[model samples]
Target: MFTSDYKYKDYIQEIYKTFSPLSWLLKIFSLDSLSRGNKQKFASSYWALAKGALTFTILAAINLFTIYYKFTWFYVELIISVKYADAVQMIYDLCQYFVDLYFVYKYGSDVFYEYIRQYAYIDGMFGMEYYGSIRRRLINVMIFMISMWFSSSLSDYVIWAIGFGLMSTTFFSMAYIYMFIKILTNLHVTVHIMHIESRLRVLGDLIQECYCSSVSCTARIEDAVIKKNWFYTIKTKTSKSQLYPLKKISYVNSNEVKWLSRCYLLLTEQVNFINRMFGMRPVTAPCWTKGLSQGEGLPIITTLGRRDGYRTRYEKMQAAYKDLLSLVQSQPINFHMAHFMRLDYPLLVSICSVFVTYTIILIQSI
Candidate 1:
């Protein structure tokens, strides 16, 4: 199943096989790039592309037909009856349908394939340790998928019990699919960010270890002079280290420092690449809980933002080491919403505030 074109074919195949079930599900919805046939590669499969397009066409047609039917049968009655709330809800549902269709189509193209390639490249560079436990990830994905389906089914039953028509329940089911895709996409992006953060953490630990190795502690006697009316008393004190043998002096070589610096630069590049690739999705999806969790979980980037004190601690190191520390300190990684706003606490607070304000207004008007 491995293709000859990709260098990391084995790794790509392993990853593809590990997540094949998820891939199959997404493929059915036209939201993934993995081929249905046994072929695996780091590039987009024409078979997947054709199948996804056909699937999307069919789904899009169904969505359009359902929207038309709902507008004609349900929303028209609501609007004629002056049920503003129901009419507004219908409009929102229509908008959501379009958004879901757009999301599926956009991600099903070569863009997702490129993302897979970049991910595989990063995995090859960092090795499997940084990727963490694949079996655990698969288990989590399965549990999440099952929970989503269960919740969707429960909601469908509730919708039915509420006297809604079959079409109405079907629309809600579609909405749930969109919600599932959005949350799963966010989860995958968060995992990627975690992987990058792990490597950055290792780099930070290496810097600390280098500093520790290069440190040479010397014991010195400190003389304190106290003068009292025509008398002088001198007190000499020695550090506790003077009582024991001096530890051997070791230094972090320039080559190691240079290597660390290069690694830091490469990692930063990957961060930027990820931001560029996945930035728009955050802007579109805008999930609060996931955004908040990511902001809190990613501490290394935040630490880099306030790295002045961190840099000061390593000021006495060699020029190369200092440069590496500066490189680490200068670049602060934040998941941005297509360069509009950062996905952090402030963004979450702002979103909640706006929602509350509008909700209050909506209730008052109603």
Candidate 2:
């Protein structure tokens, strides 16, 4: 009697379907919006996508034709060796593997080119913004998701291995590209900072030159000058040098110092935020953690200046930009790769594993 009781499960499913009118309508609308929203951008993105698909299709057809032509003798030989069916099957599997690899390589290249087109111009000229960097990866991410969804096969092991391989390659490449972008952006940002310093020095000199006849000050204010960094040397016609200590800001008094501290703190936060976005801990967080954790008397990983040392260290450089972002806020949006291109050890290691596995599979197939 219990074995024949299908009514219970059917009743439960029916009950689940019996939501109130308002809830049903709400669910329908939500689903509709989601479905529509997802494809909204595809209308425009599709044209280029179609051209890419067509090109790939032509290439694949040509490749297939050529391979068949060249391997015609092998196919005849395999047909003659009817007892070696397993070996023939392996050869077929090997050909399929190469075909899959070709598609992956083609798709990855297209997506990467699209990224370059969208970001290379502006990011090349100006430094990338925190969020801007990660947003750049959205296309590649979408491609990865789509590939994973469509690439599933009847063989779970092969599917898993291949899927993992493609994903690993995608993320590893993304992380590498992001690191390259970060280094380049940082270098450019540093150059821009140097330019700002030079302009400030020039302005200070012009001020002294224009106001020399109006003021009766004789002793140079070199001693009064605030130092920001060691490499940041500000010199004048009077042979007086304004020394800036490492990571210090040139400010007038205690108030400026406080302001600079806050500004630097914010910049530190931004850098850390970007690092976190890219899966790295901010260098400043340890310091913030160190002070707080010490006060609280806790022995957590949050402690700053740990003997083990933190992974990322951009607080000193980014601190200068904290106060400067007010200007950035008013400017048009900028893109950066600092936030998007992060991959953890798990991700990195897994990717390598996937590649090795994929290589082995390919070799076996061949």
User: Which structure among the candidates has the greatest lDDT?
Assistant: 1
Deviation from native of the Cα of residue 167 in model 1, angstroms: 6.7
Please report, as a residue range, the 10-residue window in candidate 1 with the lowest summed lDDT: 224-233
lDDT of 1 by residue, 1-366 (tens): 122347576556655555564565555555555554556543345655566557656656655776666666667645343445444544565455344445545554466566556555544543433333444675586687678777877877686858976656765465555566555555555555655655554444344444445543345721111111112111211111111113432544667667666655666566655555566553233542233213322333333333322333344345665565466456645555555455456867788789979986775575
Which residue runs of candidate 1 sit more than 4 Å off their true CA positions? 1-21, 36-39, 43-52, 75-128, 134-138, 145-149, 152-156, 162-168, 208-252, 282-317, 343-366
Instruction: Report how far off residue 261 is in candidate 2 (Å).
Output: 16
In candidate 2, position 121 carries an lDDT of 26
Off-target runs (Cα >4 Å) in candidate 2 are: 1-50, 75-347, 354-366
**Which pairs of residues collide in candidate 2?**
128-336, 132-336, 133-336, 133-337, 227-244, 228-244, 228-248, 229-244, 229-245, 286-304
TM-score of each: 0.62, 0.23
lDDT of each: 0.51, 0.31
How many residue pairs clash per model? 0, 10
**Poorest 10 consecutive residues of model 2 by lDDT?**
27-36
